[model samples]
Each structure stands twice: as structure tokens, then as C-alpha cells.
Target: MQFKWNYEPPTPERQKAAKELGEKIGMSPILANLLIQRGIKTESAAKRFFRPMLNELIDPFLMNDMDVAVDRLNDAMGRKERIMIYGDYDVDGCTAVALVYKFLQQFYSNIEYYIPDRYDEGYGVSRKGIDYAKETGVKLIIILDCGIKAIDEIAYAKSLDIDFIICDHHVPDEEMPPAVAILNPKRPDSTYPFHHLSGCGVGFKFMQAFAKNNGIPFARLIPLLDLCAVSIASDIVPVTGENRTLAFHGLKQLNQSPSVGLKAIIDICGLTNRELTMSDIVFKIGPRINASGRMQNGKEAVELLVEKDFRRALVEAGMINEYNEQRKDVDKQMTEEANSIVEKLESQKHLSSIVLYDENWKKGVIGIVASRLTEIYFRPTIVLTMSDGMATGSARSVAGFDIYDAIKSCRDLLENFGGHTYAAGLSLKAENIKEFICRFQAYVNNHIMPEQTQPILDIEEVIDFKDITKKMQADLKKFAPHGPCNPKPLFCTRNVYDYGTSKVVGRHQEHIKLELVDSRSSNVMNGIAFGQSAAARYIKSKRSFDIVYTIEENAYKRGEVQLQIEDIMPDTQKKNEK
Candidate 1:
């Protein structure tokens, strides 16, 4: 609710580069401005961002010792040695495991898959997983989305003659895991150009390398894009560089043609043989896949993605639906509990942050809760679930705050942890919870400016009624498949006439629909606000306020275009001014 509205312009060189690229790409002024704002100034950078080419992707062998990894994997295939895939328990991890297993199955049938129990073995390659691979006569183990910190587990696997090739994106510790080949881009000495691929993306690169080496034609890789695209969009990785190429093309596969498993799930989501959008994946598709892992065992989710038969996919769909219900219930309860914590903390003058630890809390939903709490409170927050004398939790933070560095400040109290700047996971002794809480708070206080720690909507421009047009939507779409580094453009409009009443329209008033019109030509755009029933009052009161939003296909019955309201403010000057 209290955003600082931080807006800073790009450097002159970056702007110049963006202008040149914009001229070359034939982008609109608005889209070009957005591009310039995001640091894509050069012709090459814009080409990569807008029209990502599969050929431009770095050679998988360019990754440190990737040649060794490929050689080891080929050796496993040649010797017919059993291989095991160890991955994290989240959707990204599940998807990574599924992708790797699917690709490796092409070369050899002796491949096995293993996902660590969120409660039992925790994140990354674990001794429990390694032992099972060993028991099953596995000679090669590949770690996906995890294993950057599995020094001990990697050592244990080595002792059992289980070689490991880690394909993870998490930050590695000072001392790396002694795997057969480590494929982490975060490695300081690594020369890989891009550093933002999700775990699934990295795993896809491995498949890409294998495919290219085998000369297994390009069309073979298309089927896998649906899974990779879903993972890329769902995991919230920055959509730039090689990630741009993967997600842009992957989204096409999801909409055009997907695997049987994906097709089944898409049908279940009431979308099949139809054009799909990021909204479809993020809201309709991804949550269901995530539900299988969060509410039920992650194995079910993996099975749903890997299943071939339509009948079996249907069965998997039913199981996924059931798990989604349970996941929703858990997410709702955890969100309420987290809200209560925020209320209590604020009531006690302890700030609006939420830091609660419960031994009984489910490990699977902590990250989801952390995400929800951060969005609700718009503050740096932490959610911890304790178990067996230890507390494992996730942290989500606002902009201008580095959660990883903050966690690092209190690392002495943590047994282990690693993640990116905005989100991280940690495990610590139960006794250290208080120390961590205090130390983390101290770190936050020392770093973040009072005004800088809020959910500020940086606006692209303030436009009048005449400037917003139907053609604008088509032009804006050049920046399609937008994500992190390349964000959907945010615009502000004011002095619009609200034609009186608002309705709670969608299937139980699940959303708010208010009729608003541009001053000129009476070009009415139905402003639909999802999950915002309270916003009707603002429109009904003849509130002449500033509205910040994106133009989206609020396709009513199919053809009507509308403005999707993201934020409503009291005045235009207040919104535009600092």
C-alpha cells in the first residue's frame, strides 16, 4: 500500500544503444522506451531479447568442464550403467528431474529418477537418495536444480561409485561439491555468457548438448519446449539472454503442440488445441503442477508430466485436481496465519514484517507463504517452519533489499543456505532462530533506506486519452513473452469517467468490473480488476483518480478489449510525482 515510487533513468550509452536497436527492430516509441529503460541498448542485445535464436545459445560445452560431463554421460550410456536423477522437491525441481530423465531415456533405458522428500532428505542431493541409487546398482547420478551445496552428499555418492553431474543455478559455496562435473553458471571462473537460467533451463541445456552431439535433428527438441517453457515461466527466472530464447520458443510449444502429459493437463485446465498465454501457465497450469508436489508427493506431479497414455493422463489429472484442492487449503491457512503474524508484529510496534517459526509447519508451502506475505505486506519478510530441532524456511524481499546478503550476514547462525538476491532458503538450529531473527533485522536496518523498502510501481509514462489506442496493444506486443528484466509496460491514466455502477461479476463476484471511458470519442474500456471486490467502491464514488495498469485482452465472450487495473491511486499528480 505504501510504495516509494522509485524511478531512475538508464545511462546515456544504454539509452543510445536502445534507440539504435529500437530503430532496427521497428519498435514503437513506448516499447522502445521500455526497452531502453531495461538496458537493452545494443542491436545484438535487442535481437537476443526480442528475436532469440536457438543457434545463438552458447555451446553447452562452454560451461566449465561440460565436455567432461558429456563424456561421462556418454560413458554411462555405452556401458549401460544405471543412472539416477536427484532433484529438489519443488515444481522447478520436479520439472528438471522429468526433463533430464526423459532425455537420458533416449540414450539408455537404465535411467532412474529420485526426488528428495522435503521433510526427510531436505533440498539437494542427499545421502538417502545416493544410497538408494547405490542400492539400485546406479553408477552415474545427475543432480538437477540442486547439489551446489551437497559437498557431503557428493562425497558419499563418490564413495559408493555413483558419479554426479550437477546442473544447478543456486549460488555455490566457497568450496564446490566434488561432483564428476559441476555445471553451475554462478561459478566465478565460469565463462558462460548468461547467468539466469532456471534449474529446468540448465537441464534443458544438457539435453541440447546431447541432442546436438548425437545429430538428432531440431524437431526432436520442440516437444520438450512445453515442459521447459512451463518451468521457465513458473519459476520466475529473468527472461533475458538464453532464457529469452528458451521461454519465447517454449511458450509457442505449450500453445501449439505439447507432450501428451502437458496436453492432458492443458485439457484438464479447460485449454486445449487453443492459443495459450503466460497467464494460462502462471495461473491455470503451473499452480496445478505445483499443487501435486506441495500438497501431495512431488512424484505424482512428475508422473503426470511424464505419463504417455491418455487414460493414465486422465487418472493423473484427477490426482492433480485433488492435490490442488489440498494445496489451496494449505496456502489459504498459511496466508491467514502469516497475516495474523504481521498484524501482531505491527500492533507491537515491531514493524510490518512477518517472521514466524512453527515446528509443525509444512516444508512444501513455506516458499509459497513467503511469496504471499511479501506481496501482501510489501516488506522484507521471512517464513520458517521448524522440525527435528532445526528450522528450514524461505525469505522473500522487496526491491532495494538483498535477501541473500541479509541471510549471509546471519550465516553464522545458519547450518546451510543458498539462493538469489530476492529469494533464498535456509536451515538452522532451532536454538539459533532468535539470533537469526535479531541479526537479520539488524542487517535490514543497517542497509535499506526507510523509503526504499516498499512495493513501488515504476511508471513508464503518463499518457492522456488520445494517446492510448487499440493499435497500441498490437505495437506493445513486440515486447511479448515479457518477464523479470523485460517487464510488461506499466502506464498511468487519469480523469477518466466512470459510468457509475460496479459489479462483482465473475462466477461469485470473484472479480470487479467497472466501466470507464476515455474522454475523447467515448472510447470505453471495461476496467476489470481481478480479485479486487473492494475496488468497486472507489469507482462507484465517482472517484476521479489515477489508474496504473496494463492493456490486456479482458476478452469478454471473446472479442472485447479492456484495461486490466493493476493499481489505483487517489490522484494523478501524486502518482506521477515523487
Candidate 2:
């Protein structure tokens, strides 16, 4: 797929200021430029960004209802109340439950955890989960990663004499649940400094407050950060502010001294010798952790996360690995089937959205399929399957589109729907599927701009090949743990010629390996464009091109930096336009 490169230029004043700051800090100009681009303009901001200290974390009591949540937990613990840690089935939820449950276990043994089965209890707070709490004689329930929208469920639990402390991070509806304390920063009345925390991050903050109130030093809770980091990475939350600090420290803990379960997973994935990055967790650890809930019971994932013995954790990790393999196979097959359905649609070219449904589709993998479909269709996409006699589905949207709003427009047909701007989940009567698809397409067609449908490569700046250097790469390393809002910088180098050594190099020759030389400086650099073998033809024709890429150290060749090409376009400005 081709992308429109959107160049972002820094102001001259800002550039000069950053350069001066870099000189003061004894760093390179490129590093300074990148830092300034990320809003780290001053020496103090640079120090905070590069060396995130745990003490820099905001006080947990500042969050809305945080003190009340802590008081409620203390009350439960003092009375020896049976407290249940309730969470959703995904990684964020499971990790949240594990983090809180394990922390509580350190002082109290009366606490237990409950992860509702995805197949039986769709998502969030459910009657089955509440009923389980009642059966276990639980007096207090700590709801994590969910329950912000469970007004009715919370009411029902309250009726059963159960109190709830919600720690969700999703966008909440206007009518909040009557929990003892709601710890979601997204709450309109919330005063938390950072609002983009993951579900587990909120749970971590709750524990932080609890530790402080109980006279337990906050430093003692640092070991729980690995779980928080996994949740942040897996949940796709913005890695900025407190989230960055948590993820940074959490990743260090994960690399240096991970929990037994995380260590087992790292070993099983053959990553024991290497440091794991956010991408590694997202692709390697996250999926395996999620596969348990997607393919089987989420309780297994929580169990693995809470396991204390390395030997037992390995056994559990092995079982989870098998589930992951099964998940992959199901996901691949369903995606292919969804693609074929899109191909067979006669109006596919004119349609503003892609909506497909299959009765046989496993609900577990439909979300993955919806995301995969968007890569091919590049529009608001929904993949639905029959679940409990209802048409249940997951919706994925383009970059600028509000999929939740579009889905909301069809609320008349939906029994329930909730999520954020880019992704959402919904279920409706089987007969409403056709109407929902038609109305959804109409809404997107009217609201989505033409350019919004096309993929966009957000280039941070345009730079010469000579600007790429070992010092620049070293300085960029300080920008550890990059994600939304603070993404790795993408630079576009224009009018670069690929040396004759350029060749297609991957197992299927699907990647282009090129030695590029800047037209202005004659500086050479190695560039690799994965899944871009088509670009080899342009290289073979000796065409000058503009390439958007991120600089990375080529680990295989020690001490060598290379360009990881994001997109390539022919040098069009040099040619006369029509």
C-alpha cells in the first residue's frame, strides 16, 4: 500500500533552542532535534525524559476517589472481608487482576481473583462473575480494566451486598456505576494528572496509595511493574508521562528480574538473553498471554501471571504457548475467509466500509480479523460472527475516523456497543446485521474525508544522509520506550540513489536491501524496506527516490546503523508536472 508522506517541520527558533540545549547537555544536534520534537525542550525535561525516576510518578491520592478506594480496601482487609479481584479477559484485565491480587496476597490471604470466561461472559462485568463473587461469600470486589460502563451490573452486585472499586481506563458513559470508588481517569470529574493510564496502571496506582496509607514503602511495590508494563504495551495505551515512566521501569524489571511467569514466558519465547522492548511484548509476550483468554479460559492467564514457582510457571507457559499456536491458526484462516468475502462483494470498490459476518467464525479471533481487514481495505471495518444467537462483532477504524461514533449512530439496531474512537465492540439481533452494516456505511461515507481513507506516513522531518550518525543513534537510544504521542522519529531523505548492490533479500525475496547514497552529500547508508520488493524495480532502473525511514542499529552487524524504510517514492519534484 502506498502512503502520503506528511512532513512535519520544526520552527527555526525551536531548532536553534534545541541545538543550544544539546550543546549545554553535551549531546548531538539530531538528538536535540528529536527531543524538542517530542516536547522535551529544556535540560530538566530532557533529564526527566531520558532518566525517568520512579519518584517522578504522580501521587496516587491525586486521582479521583483514590483515597476512598484505599479506605474501602483497608476496611475490607481489617474486617477480614472476602475480597475478589474481578477483571476482564484480555491482557490488561488479567494483568490488572494479577497485580492487585498478588499485592493483596502479600499482606492478606483472604483475597481471591476471578477472570470471567470470554465465551461465557463476553467482556467487562457480568452477572456470572458477580454471582461467583456471591457464591464465594465475597464482600468487596475490585473491578479492573472494566466496569466503568457496567451500571446495571454494579447495581446488581450492590444489591447482593457487594461493594465495587472500579479501576477502568476506558471512556465512560455519563451515568457512572455506583461503585464504592471509581478510579478511572477518564471520568469527567477526575483530577488525575495523567489520564491515559492502562487498566493495570490504574490498579498499580491503587496499590501505591494502599501501600502509602499502610506505611509500606512505595519502593517495595516496584517489583509489580512488570505486570503493569505488559498491560500498558499490550493495551496499546499512549506511552507518555506516567505511563512512560511506569513502562520504562517496568521493562527494566522485566529484563533484569521478571516475575516467574514472565520469566517462563521469556524463556519459552527464546528471549532470555536479549532485552525485551515494547514491540517484543506486543508481538511475542502479549499475544501468548492473550491467547489463553481468546482460545480458552482467561483464568489460566491470570494463574500463570500469579504463579510464584518458576518450575510451575514454565509448565503453565508451555500450555499457554499451545493455545497461542491454536489462536494463530484460527486467526489466519478466519482472516483469509474474511478477505475472500470482501473480494466477492460487487460494490466493494464503492463501499466506504467493510462489514462481513460468518456464523462459523470464532468470536475469539474476529477482532484480529477486523484489524487485519483494515490493513487491506484501509477503511472503517467490522467483522461479525454469531454469538449466543446475536450478531456480535469488533469494529476497527481508520486513523482519523471515529468508529465508536459511527457504531453509535446505529445504536437503534445494536443491543450493546462500547469502545473508543479507533476501535469498538458491539452486538445486535441477527436480523439487524444488514441494517447495521448499511447505516454504518452511510454514516462513514458522510463523515469520513477522502484523504482519511488512505494511509498516511507521518514524517517527523526531512534530513540528509549525512545527518545520520553513530552519535545520533546513541542519543536516540535515550528515547526509550516509544509509543503513541512519543513515536520514533521518521525522517525522509530526498533524491537518494540506490547503489547497484541493492537487491531483494528476505526468505521470499519480499524485502529490498539497498545501499543508498545522498545526492547532495555523497554519504552512503544501508537501507532495508521489508515487504517492499516492488521497490527493487525502481532501484534496478536507477531511479532517484525519497525514502521515509527510522534509524536503527543493525544488531547482526555490530556498531552499524541502518535505515528501516517505512515508505519510498520516486523523486517526483525533479520531473515536470502535467
C-alpha RMSD of each candidate structure in angstroms: 2.9, 1.7
How would you encode candidate 1's per-residue C-alpha lDDT over 1-578 as one tens digit per residue? 54444345556765566566667877655566677777766666766666787777788877887888888888889998988887877768888988888876776788878877766777777777887887899998888998898898888888888898999998888899888899988888888888888999889888887777878876677778777888878888887778878888888878777877888888888887557876678888888888876776677888878887988998898789778888878888988987886777654244535577877778778888999988877767888997656799998887667889989888888998988888899999988898888888777877877665566787776666566666676777667787777777877777776776567788877687877764555666677777777566666777576677787765544445577877766554465675
Q: How many clashes in candidate 2?
A: 0
Clashes of each: 2, 0
TM-score of each: 0.92, 0.96
Quick one: best TM-score, which candidate?
Answer: 2
Tens-digit per-residue lDDT, 1-578, candidate 2: 97877866777887798789889888877678878877788898899888999997999999999999999999999999999999988899999999999998999999899998888888888999899899989999999998898999999999999999999998887789999999988899989989999999999999999999999988789999999899989888889999999999999999999999999999999887886899889999999999999999899999999999999999999999999999999999999988898998989789789999899999988988999999887988999998888889999988879999999888889888787788789999998888888899999999999999999888877789887778878888878797877888888888889777889998899999889897878777998999999778877888798889989888578679989999888756336331
Candidate 2, poorest ten consecutive residues by summed lDDT: 569-578
**Which candidate number maximizes lDDT?**
2
Error of 2 at 105 (Å): 0.5
Off by over 4 Å in 1: 4-27, 41-48, 346-353, 500-511, 519-521, 531-538, 541-543, 557-559, 572-578
